[model samples]
Target: MRPGHGGFITVKNTLLHCYCVCGKIEDAHHLFDEFPQRNDLISWNTLMGDYLHVSQPRVIVDLFKEMCIGGFEASVTTVLYLLSAIGELGSYLGGESVHGYCIKMGFSYNLHVVTALIYVYAKNGEIDLARWIFDGVAVKDVVLWNCLVGKYAKCGMVEEAVALLLGGGLVGELSPGEGESDVVVDPATSSLNLNKSAEESTPPKLSQP
Candidate 1:
């Protein structure tokens, strides 16, 4: 690698991300294609993430397939973006394949990854699988708890949702200030809303090797 080439790639990737954030999908793709280090996993993930942000989930799935064919190793960030896209598309099979891959890669236990998995399963109406995943996590955060409970409510399991809300010790857990505001439930409407934490939306910083 030539001196400053890595820096140049970093700058270009940043510009690509900015384009995506600004909703300039075409410009972002063009910038991504022009990169000399376009093969970098970070660049692929960034572009895919941007496509997902713009509601172009189909684009993300295609990009993911291309990235795999290019022999790029997916990081947790990549999996999260892919899972979100799959969830949007309601593709149970695709979610399952990604879930299997996460287990194979040892990423299934990661909190963010697990949360994404729960989302994909729940969105696909596989609430049982989502609950199983929630049960598998011994140490649960409010986000995880809220995810399952909210999914249950959304699935019309109001009784179970209320039970988990009142009997599952979530109220007690909130007293300690652990994601208290993230879980909101309305008994009258039997509606549950789980606000995503900042960490859930922000991709981890990438360090170029």
Candidate 2:
């Protein structure tokens, strides 16, 4: 805690973030390791995020465990990164543990977290659990809607996926027992192979401001 010590840490964190953004992950990691305050949450999160960006999910998971062992309480950003890594690794048990942590820590209601949960479950072939999580959200965003629908489609539940879109589930307006006749399905939608479409579609990113 010298004068301007916090500001110095901020500057270093900024540089680390810049290096990561510029795809210089090694440089970023080097800078992070050199930080006087390795306990800095921003630095930890930034480095972990860069690892995630590089598709080094195991690295991210390792860093997450280190961060936890260091007694740093995870923020939403931290959880998002960890969840994405777990999903990429196809660790159903890890995803479930994180889901429980989110609920315990009061992040389960966050739209981004919920979306990530859906993704992890779907990726692990737990589509039913994903759907259950989706149904619990009272408010929905386009990203969340796309996530669930895409997951269903990816799992070859074409009817469920199509019903979501056609029944206005995207807008949270789907009513129980709503018949397909109430809404018009576009010709393109009718012929589209939802599984293929889902395959080409990228899942929404879990971003924080």
Candidate 2 residue 123 C-alpha distance from true site, Å: 1.1
How badly does each model clash, as a count of residue pairs?
A: 0, 0
lDDT of 2 by residue, 93-121 (tens): 99999999888987776666777788888
Model 1: lDDT equals: 0.69
Measured over all alpha carbons after superposition, the RMSD of each candidate to the real structure, in angstroms, is: 8.7, 11.2
Clashes counted in candidate 2 amount to: 0
Looking at model 1, residue 86 earns an lDDT score of 87
Among all windows of 10 consecutive residues in model 2, the one with the lowest summed lDDT is 179-188
Tens-place lDDT per residue, model 1, 63-92, is 989888888877776777788788878999
**What TM-score would every model get versus the actual structure?**
0.78, 0.76
**Which runs in model 1 stand beyond 4 Å of their true positions?**
1-6, 172-209
